[model samples]
Target: MSNLSGKTAIAGIGATEFSKDSGRSELQLAAESILAALTDAGLTPADVDGLVTYTMEKNPEVEVARALGMGDIKYFGRVNFGGGAPGAVVLQAAMAVATGVADVVVCYRAFNERSGRRFGAGVQDRGTEPSAENAGYAWYTPHGLVTPAQWAAMAGRRYMHDSGATTEALGAVAVAARRHAATNPKAWFYERPITLEDHAESRWIAEPLRLLDCCQESDGAQALVIVSAERARDLPQKPAIIKAAAQGISGSTAMMTAYYGDDIGHLTEMTLVADQLWADAQLTPADIPTAIIYDHFTPYVLMQLESFGFCGRGEAKDFVRDGNVELGGRLPINTHGGQLGEAYIHGMNGVAEGVRQIRGTAVNQVADVQNTVVTGGAGVPTSGLILGADR
Candidate 1:
């Protein structure tokens, strides 16, 4: 077992209301969520000794610490890769707590993605100002593969061709996500469920990719509290144990385009992460009673299931079609709705949902959910976690 496993636990989770327009600054959202999480964990700002957040977050770590009145942060760090950083943030926090670097740590992500700056709109030059990331994008934008949807389209098309998966197969993912979202009161798409027909009828943003297949651009923030398992036992809410956490970046990876790889349809990076997660936790796909796979785009959900060994290669379509992803299914996924139906806070909300499931407090709670798998962004260098209920 990994040294971090079973050492730290998620004591609390908090989030701002999911919405298209938060009507508040991102900094305010971050501060509010952090405070809420601390309150839930039965800890004051003075108790926090570490902080972790995404590099994409506009709020500075010192600024959040200052806003919260946290005393002398002992550890602080940031993970990168857009939505891929959410679970990684929790991992960083868990490491800090488990290693005795900090007694209490907060992991947070907040942004006004839709209302302030849209990430889907292809940019001319994100890294033109002499950053290493700009140098990475230089290879693709010149070829007109700029937008996220367009970049993902290349691999998505290959998956369809190789596996003979139809648009309907992709539609199943969107339908399931929206169905769960429709039931979740906090979901932005609450009471607005979509059917497979709706998915098919939706206009295409990229060929074989419909509007319904895309995740929403949301404005919000989410925060999680990590502390020693012993400390979590005294918190207000039940703790979600950090069974395992891992981040993976495959060789020859690119921003959103890795077309030159040996297999365009495979998610080798996620596969690599999955291998470590199950090993670290001493669990398998069968051990996961539920999952919160990242669904920034629908196709990647299918690929993620396959990469995580939920089913055999090219069998995700059949697995999903057999109702394995719905409520009461073998591996109910995105039960808190997903990026598709829920507001997309760059997958941070997904992590919050995973904690809820482990706590047995999810609106669509699975019975006897002792273990759950939560994944970060797909189609990029991503991360994942295996969360278990605190015994």
Candidate 2:
């Protein structure tokens, strides 16, 4: 096992309410969530010596620290990519604490995605640039593959075509997430459950990807407190020990539009991440009874299951159909509703749910959840985490 495994733990998790309009600035959301997390950890701003967030976050570490009245900070870092950053931010914090670079580090992501900057609305013309990030999009953006759903549709369609899977397979993911959300009072879709027929009738944003197949573009913030395992054991809340943390990039990695890779039907990046997570944690799919699978798009959820070795390639459709991914099943995924039924805080909320399951305090708590898998966004240079109960 890696030296980082079991060395750091998530002492607390917090989030702002999920909604279409937060009616607040991203900075305020970040500050609120951070304070809430510190309080949950039975800590104070004075105890924090580090901060981590996504590179896309507008609030700088020093600025947020200033807002929170936090004292001297020894370490601060940022991870790139959109939804793929959730686990990565925690990874950064865990590394900092494990390596003695910081004592207590908080990972946060706050955004006004729905009201301020909707990601599903597709990309805008910022003119041309000589940058590599822009160049990667040039190959497909002009072809009208701008929105995340559209980019993901290309892969989803291919997976269906190759695996003989129908749109019903995708709807299965949506239905399960909503079912879990129906009972989760904190979820936006609370008491709002849908059937496979409802998913089938939903308007198609992109072919093979119905509106329900897409995750919500929500306005919210989520945060987590990371500290040494020994320190966390002394805290009031049950610590979600960091069993493993990993990030990976595959051939010609390019956000969601990695169609040029060896196989457009597979999430190779996530496969790489999954391989490392199990190895680093010295665990396997059998050990994890539940997971917080990234559901930015439903099709990717199926792909992630296969990539993580939960099932054979092209067999995820069958696996999900067998009632294995829902409550009382073999692997209850996204028990807190996921990005589809819950709020989309760039997968940070999903990570929080994993911690809750470890603490046995989740609204849709799974039985015997010794460990839970938390994955970042797929179809990109993604990240994943394995959170287990304190040993």
Candidate 3:
């Protein structure tokens, strides 16, 4: 639809070993991942002239640039809404490269979520500073609705009530992700598989959300290198073409809470993203052979399928019922294991998986993957990407 579509490509993807504890500073993790990506792309740190990352990212761009000895960075920016920003980082890097803002750009995310401050543990302090942003969180912090799981559970419960979906259906996503992860050495749950019975027996974080339903608290970093498609063709590895990158916020959207909207059971924001991505790429679900939905919670994955038109509303339960998302299924999804099976790198790992699928190098690689859809965080203002192999 525009120059941004198919003009840029993801040339490289890199990540540190995903673990519950990195035992290092977040800055070190960021630098390690960036360097690894540059190496993977057969480039040096000097090749980088632009950088994009998440607003919640602890490592500042300047520090990263200084650490890598990069010169005269032409562009540096950050995306918002936590995990919602991962796909948007690619959008930013692609726009910068396509528009002559920079020649080589890298988008990255790094964190020590498990060893440091755990978002799942809830807000630790309410300082006396009465700020507007803090006040926004204040609205939901009380009444025992603090952490992300609690916030997301509201809509998850409503979806079950409306769609008549069972907890077993939700567990199916975890099962599929784990099944894929079992073969992926990079996955934290590597060689470990779970059954529906295991998911059923797990402890509940919230009423409708089980321990297995939630993504893991992980310490890791992931990075992607983007350059013009013309330049990417000459690089070391096959390029994952940036067919489309879109960010969207539904009218009544809020971070992890959009209960006021008409369809509490559906992800209106992902629907908005799907419309723009389809228009930008001139493709639809029928063209995509694989997908990597953000799995902060299993219920959101189902909603995203409906939002992306992979299935009808309230039909995701049926869609995932019978190995539909596994290796030989119609649409093999989360083949690198999603956040449930792989480490949760705030959705960046999912993007890397999408790129790997395009390059035919994923550990659980699908066959003849012409297009793969990678989604950012749901239950908030979000983003999505359609990465195609260079044609």
Q: What number of clashing residue pairs does each candidate have, in the order they appear?
A: 0, 0, 0
Clashing pairs in 1: none
TM-score of every model versus the real structure: 0.97, 0.98, 0.98
All candidates' lDDT scores? 0.88, 0.91, 0.91
Which regions in candidate 3 have their CA more than 4 angstroms from the true location? 124-128
Candidate 3: lDDT over CA atoms?
0.91
Candidates sorted by lDDT, descending order? Answer: 3, 2, 1
Expressed as tens digits, the lDDT of each residue in 274-373 for candidate 1 is 9989999999998888899999888889899999999989988888885679897888899999999888988888888999998889999999889999
Where's the lowest-lDDT run of ten residues in candidate 3?
122-131
- C-alpha lDDT of candidate 2 relative to the true structure: 0.91
lDDT of 2 by residue, 270-351 (tens): 9888998999899999999999999999989999999999999999889888567889887889999999999899999999
